[model samples]
Target: MSIPALDAQGVRGPAPAAAPRATTPRRSRPAHAPGRVKVWQRWVSPLAALAVWQIASTTGLLPQSLLASPSTIAVTAAGLISDGTLPAAIAVSLQRVAAGFLLGGITGILLALAAGLSRAGENAVDPLMQMLRALPFFGLIPLFILWFGIGETPKVALVALAVSFPLYLNTFAGIRGVDGKLAELARTLKLGRAALVRHIVLPGALPQTLVGLRQSLGVAWLALIVAEQVNADAGLGFMINDAREFLRTDVIVVGLLVYSALGLLTDALVRLMERRALTWRRGFLGE
Candidate 1:
């Protein structure tokens, strides 16, 4: 049997061997890892689809009357842009959407705050909101036109209506879904009501509130499309309607493309906002 080794105030079977120092330096991952897909790679699929569409249109597999060739639509879009028709229409549409979004967003946040902060407010507000939400908002077009007249008021109102529900629902859910432990901690910390809400509750609820904003924006566009169809003399919807009467499929396609592009642009803006606002968030997607 081996005899134990003894040191000052210590005893051991054998002297401990020194841990070997690492020969190779440890490699650390970059703070912002590269995306799985390259930037150019992301565009490949869309470009391929566009090429196929152009080929089909050129080969007469797709009829021009039914769907214009991408080239023809591009030309039509260029002409409209040069004539300032597209810009004017876009401006009008944008104004309506912006106005409506502001109004609806304010209403939603207020309602959500009220219901989220108070049981009595929730009892009074939630049931009516839920009932209103159950109905297809698009179905309210006739009623809106009658009440607000077949003008800008009805169009703006429609967008507002479309925007409000998503925001209200999501904001309410976010407020309620705040971690109970965090709220308890806030209380334990002796946080004032204002301080608790400003620091803890609002920050915690912000992620879902932002999600609601995105959804509301999407629905707002859809509502604007339908609203503009009602007695619209200007805007993309009017442009499409005018093109339809003249059997100008190319022009119609251009208008539709513009609508799609706008939707994508707005969504991208929201995504950028999320990246900036939610820097603390890390999930599978972030990796």
Candidate 2:
């Protein structure tokens, strides 16, 4: 037994057990998780792919008529830049997509809010949306063209139509999937609907809503491609078609690459938003 320890005032008590040092909890790193790779490492595969393509082109291993190699495509792309056709097409296409995306995205979010917030809203809105959602978004090109004519209106409308469904579905599901207990707690706190949505509902739905945004963007690009291909267009699609008539495979390849790069760029943007928006979560992303 330990003897009591007395202070200057002469207190009697069992010797205070050696005070255990306060320790901070150590965070465990995920297993088999290598540290973040360098940014250049992410480009390794694509660079290697380009190298292979270049080799094949230089060796004449691939038919230039059928498949223009990376170097040829690069040369064509450079020429297009010099000529300004490519740049103008890019501008026109970007304008159409931006307009369509804004219109469709807003419509989707609003409808989702209406449906998610009330049973009556769901009954009134969901059926019509579902019916339209059933129709192939691209297939409506004919109708859109007939109604809006073979113009920018049909192209933009097609993109908007294609984009809206995914956003609506994902936003609706995300809002509805929020924890019921949280809703009850909000009610107990006498939170106004506006405050309730701002503080809890919207935050809960953000992850999935972002997912929908990504999907909608992808669909928007797809719709743009199809819509542009449908008529006498002033976009990349038109350029690609014109190149086909000239048997300019390199130009076609360049157009395809530009489209791909646009998709990748936009996807990267959304991913950046996701990382920023979901910073509070701790998981695979290590946010």
Best by TM-score: 1
Candidate 1 residue lDDT tens string, 221-277? 999998987679888889989989888999988888888899988888887888788
* TM-score per model over all chains: 0.81, 0.80
For residue 104, model 1's alpha carbon misses the true position, in angstroms, by 1.1
Residues 137-172, model 2: lDDT tens digits: 777877887899987899888888888899999999
- Stretches off by above 4 angstroms in model 2 are 1-61, 283-287
By TM-score, how accurate is candidate 1? 0.81
